[model samples]
Target: MATIKDVARVAKVSVGTVSRVLNGSSKISPESYKAVHDAARQLGYRRNAVAQALVSKTSKMFGVLVSDVGVPFFGEMVKGIEEVARQKGLHLLICNGYHDATEEKNMIEYLLSHRCQSLVVHSKGLSDEELIQYSREIPGMIVINRYIDAIKERCVFLNNHQGMHIAVSRLLDSHNGVAYIGSSEDIQDATDRYLGYQKALEDRSIEFNEQWVVHCEPVAEAGYKAIKQLAEQGELPSSIVTYNDALASGVLDYLHGEGIKIPEQVSVVGFDDIELARYLYPKLTTVRYPIREMAEFAANLSIQLLEDATPSVSDEELEFVPKLIERNSAVI
Candidate 1:
C-alpha cells in the first residue's frame, strides 16, 4: 500500500527523484538511488503501473491475439512472445478467439480500450483496412500467421507451400499415391497447403486424382469422417497428409480400428509438429513450424514500431519456412 509519495517522504527526496529511480533513469545520483531503494524496501513500496502509464502515455502492456490458445502451436508461440516481453520488462495480455472473427474483433476493441502499447495479432479475423486504421491510431501493431495489404505491418508467418512440398515429396518418394485431409476451399492456409500438395504431385510426375483428395474441417472428427467417406468411395490413397497433428491422430485411430496398418498399409504425414507428435504410439512425421521464433520476432518488432519513428517493415508479405521432421508415422 506504500505509494511513491510515501517513499519520497521517507527518503527525504522529491517525488520526481523517486519516479526517476523507479524508471531506472540515469539522471539520479548514487546517494539518491541508495536512499530511495532503502526507503522503498522499508515502506514495502511498489511502482504503480497504471499511474506511470497515465503520466508517460504508455501502458507498458502488449496484446496477443491467437486463433486458439489450446493448440500446441499457439502455446509455443505464446511462450516465445512471453519470453521477449519479460526480457523487455513488459506484460502480455493473451486473447483466444477460437478462430472466430467476431470474437477477435471484440478482443481487439477490449485491448485498445485498456491502452495496450502494441498488438500482436496471429489470426485471420480482421480485414486489412481495419487493421491499418488501428495501427494508424495505436502505438504499433504486428500481424502473425496472416497478412494484411493496407497496413505496412510486420508479419511473421509460415511457409505453408514449402511445408506441404516436403510432406508430399516424402509421401511420393516412399509411396505411390497420397491423399490430403484438411479444410476445403474456404480457409486460405488449407487451400495453400492443398496447392502445395498438388505442386509436389506435378513435380514428381504423379497424376492428380480428385477422388483421392478429401476436404474436412481442421478437427479430429473431421478426419475420422473424411476417412470413413473415403473408405466407402473405394478411393483411399496409399498415404495421407493432414493439415495438422490433431486430424492425423484421428486418421491413425480410424485406420487402426478398421484393421488397417499405418505406414505399412497407408503412410501418414501431419503439419505443425505439436508436442503430441512425440508422445503418440507411432511418432508423427510433421512440419516443424518456427512458432517461437515467429512469435518473438513479431513481439519485438511490434515494440520497435511503437518506440521508434520508423516503421517495422515496409513490405507487405513476410513468411517463415517450415522444416520437415521425419518420424515414425510416414514411410521412411
Candidate 2:
C-alpha cells in the first residue's frame, strides 16, 4: 500500500528522484539511490508494474520463442537464457511453437505486440525475409541455432562444421567405415554436417559413400527405422555417427534388442550431449555443444540491442565449435 511519494518523503528526496532509482535509470546519484531503496524496503513498497509499463513503454520482460520445447537441446539453451534473464532482473515469457511455422509466426507477432523488451527465437521454418522484417520492426531480437543471412547480426549458431569434422574423424580412424542417421539432407544443419563428414573423409583419403547416409526426421523413431532398414538390407556399417543423442539412443535401443554389441560390433557417436547420454546403459560419446554459453550470450546481446548499444548490432553472427565428449559409445 506504500507509494513512491511516501518513499520520497522518508528518503528526503523528490518523487522524481525516487522514480529514477526504482526504474534503474542509472542517472540518480548512488547515495540518493541507496536511501530511496532503504525507504521503499522499510515501507514495504511495491511497484505497480502494469502502470509503470503503460507510462514508460517497458515491461522488463523478454520473450523466448522456441520451435520445439520438447527437444533437449532447446531445453538446455532455455535454461541458460533464463539464468541470465534472472540475473538482469528480467522475466521470461516462453512460447513453444511445437515446430509449427504458423504458430512460430503468430507467437512472434504476439510477443512484439505485448511490448516484450526483446525476443530470442529458435526457429525451424521461418524464412529469411520474415525474420528480417521482424527484426526491422523490433530491432532487438535474436534468432538462436538457425542462421538468416538477411538478419545475420541477429542470429547465433553452433559450429556444426567443426563438430561434424571431429565426429567423422573419430569414426574414420577407429572404424573402417561409418554411416550417418537422422534428418533430411535438405536441412541446413544436416547438409553442413554431411559436408563436414565428406571433407574429413577426403582429408584422410577415404572414399565418400553416399549409400551410408540415411535421411529421416531428427527423431528416435526415425533413427530406429533407418537402422532397421539397414539391418534388413545387410548393409550395416562398422560405425555410425548420429545427428543428436535422440537418434543415438534409438540406435542403441534397436541394436541392443537385436543382441548386437556396441563399439565392439559397431561404434556409435552422437551430437549434442543431452543429459540422458550419461545415463544410458552404455554412456554415449557425443559432442559437447556450448548451449548454455550460446544462450546466455544471445540473451545478453538482445539486452544490449534493446539498450541501443551501437556495437551490439555491429557484431557478426557468432558460432561456437563443439568438442567431442568421449565415452563408452565411441573408442578413445
Candidate 3:
C-alpha cells in the first residue's frame, strides 16, 4: 500500500532521490540510498514493475513464448532460459501460444504491452515476414528452434534436415531398409526432417519407397498406429527414423509387443534425444537437439542484444548442429 511519495516523505528526501535509489541509479548518494532503503523497508513498500518500466522504458523481465509449457521439451528449454534469467536478476513472463498464429500474435503483443524489451520466442505458427518485423521492432527479440533468413542473426535453431540426415545416414551404414515416421504437423521442422530422410536415401543410391513412410500426429499413440499400419500392410522396414523421441517410443512399444527384437530385427532412430529416450526398453539411438544449450544461448543473446549496440555474432552463428546419440535401440 506504500507509494514512492510516502517513502520520500519518511526518508526526508525528494521524490527524485527515492526514485533513483529504487531504480538502482548510480547517481544517488550513499546517504539517500540508505535512507530510501530503510524507509521503504519500514513501510513494506514494493516497487511497481509496470510503473518503473513506464518511466525507464524497460524492465528486468524476459518474455518467453512457447507452444506449450507442459511439454517436456519446452520445459527443459524454459529451464535453460530461467537459468540465465536468474543469474542476471531478471524474471520471466512466459506465455503459451499453442502453435496458433492468432494466439502467438496476441501473446507477443501482450508481452510487448507489458514493456518486455527482451523476448525469446519459439513460434511455429507465425510467418517469416511477421517474425522478421517483430525482430526489427524489439531489438532484444530472439527466435528459438526456428529460423528466418532475413533475421538469421536473431535466431537460435537446430538444423532439422541435417539432424535427420545424420540419423538416417547412420542407420544406412548397416541397414538398407529405412522407414520414416513423419509428423503430420505443418511446420518447417517436419518438412525438413522428411526431406532429410528422402535425401539420405537418394545419396545412398537406394530407390525411394513411399510405402514405408507415414505422416501422422507427433505423439506416442500416433506413432504406435503408424507402425501398426505399416506392419498390417505387409512388412516394416529394417530401420526406422522418427520425427521425435515420442514417436520412437511408440514404435518401440509396438515392436516389443510383436516379439520383434530391437537392433537384432529392426533398428530405430529418433530425433530430439529427450530424457524419455534414455529410459526406453532398449534405450534409443537419437539426435541430441541440445535444446537446453540452445535456450541458454538464446536468453543470453537476448540480454546482449538489449544492452550492447554491436550485439554478438552478426553472421549465421546462431545455427546449431545436432549430435547423434547412439544407444541400445539401434545397431551399427
Candidate 4:
C-alpha cells in the first residue's frame, strides 16, 4: 500500500532523492539513503520491479525452455540456471516444450513476448534454420545440447559422439556380444550416439548387426520393454549401451526380475550420470553429461551477450566432453 511518494514524505526528503536511494545510485548522500531505508521499513514499502524494468527497457528476468521439467535431467539444468540467475539478481521464467517443434516455437515466442532479454534454450525438435533465425532475432539467446554451425558461438553442448564412443569401447573391451539401446527421437543426439556405437564396433573389428540395436522412448518403461523385446528374439547381448540413465535403470530392473546377474552374465553402461544411477543395485557405470555446469555457463553467456557489445565464447565452454564414471554395473 506504501509508495515512493509516501516514503519520501515520511523521510522528509524529495521524491527524486528517494528514487536515487532505492535505485542504489551513487549520487545520493548516505544520510538520504539511510533515511529513505528507515522510512521504507517503517512503512513496509516495496520497490516496483515492473516499473523499474519499464524504465530500464530490460527485465531483471532470465528465460529457460527445456523439454520436460518433470524429468530429473532438466531439473538439474534448471537448478544450475537458477543458481547463476539468483546471483545476478535475476529470476527465471521457465517453459517446457515437451519435445514438440510447434510447442518449442510457441514457448520461445511466449518468452520473447514477455520482454525477456536473456534466454537459455534446450530444443530437440526445431531445425537448424529455425534456430538460426531465432538466434539472429534474439542476440542473448543461447542453445544447449545441440550444435548449429551458423550460431556456433551461442551454443553450449556436449560431445555426444565421443560420450557414446567411450561407453561402447568400455563394453567391447570385455564382452564379445554388445547391443545398443537408443532413443527413438529423431534428434541429432540420438543419431550421433548410434553412429558412435557403430564406429566403436568397427574399430574393434566387431561386425555390426541391426538386430543388436533397438530404439525406444528415452524412459525407464521403454527401456524395460526394449530389453524384453530383445529377450523375446533371443538376441540379448552380453553387454549393453543405453541412451541414458533412466533407460539403463529400467534394463537393470528387467534383468533383476529375470534372475540375471549384472556384471556377471550381462554388463550395462549408460549415458548421463544422474543421481539414480549411483543408487541402483550394482551401481550403474555411466558417462557424466555435466549438464549443471553447461546450464550455468549458458545462463552466464546469455547475460553477457545482452550486456556486452561483443561477447566471447571459449572453446572449452562451448564443447564439453563427457567423462566416464566407473562403477559396479560393468566389467573391464
* Global local distance difference test of model 3: 0.89
**lDDT per prediction?**
0.80, 0.81, 0.89, 0.89
What's the best-to-worst order under lDDT? 4, 3, 2, 1
Q: Write the per-residue lDDT of candidate 1 for residues 260-316, one digit (tens) a residue.
A: 887788888889888898877588888887788888888888888766847546453
* Model 4 lDDT tens row, 254-318: 99999998989999999999888999999999999999999999999988887784686677769
**RMSD of model 1 against the true structure:** 11.2
Give Cα distance to truth, residue 8, candidate 2, Å: 43
Q: lDDT tens digits, residues 148-259, model 2? A: 7777777888878789889989778777787888577355778778778888888898887777878788788888888887778776888999888888888999999998
lDDT of 3 by residue, 70-95 (tens): 98899999999999999998889999
TM-score of candidate 1 relative to the true fold: 0.78
- Candidate 4 TM-score to native: 0.82
RMSD of each: 11.2, 12.1, 9.9, 11.1
Q: Whole-model lDDT for model 1 versus the true structure?
A: 0.80
Error of 4 at 75 (Å): 0.6
List TM-scores for all candidates, in order. Answer: 0.78, 0.79, 0.83, 0.82
Each candidate's clash count: 0, 0, 0, 0
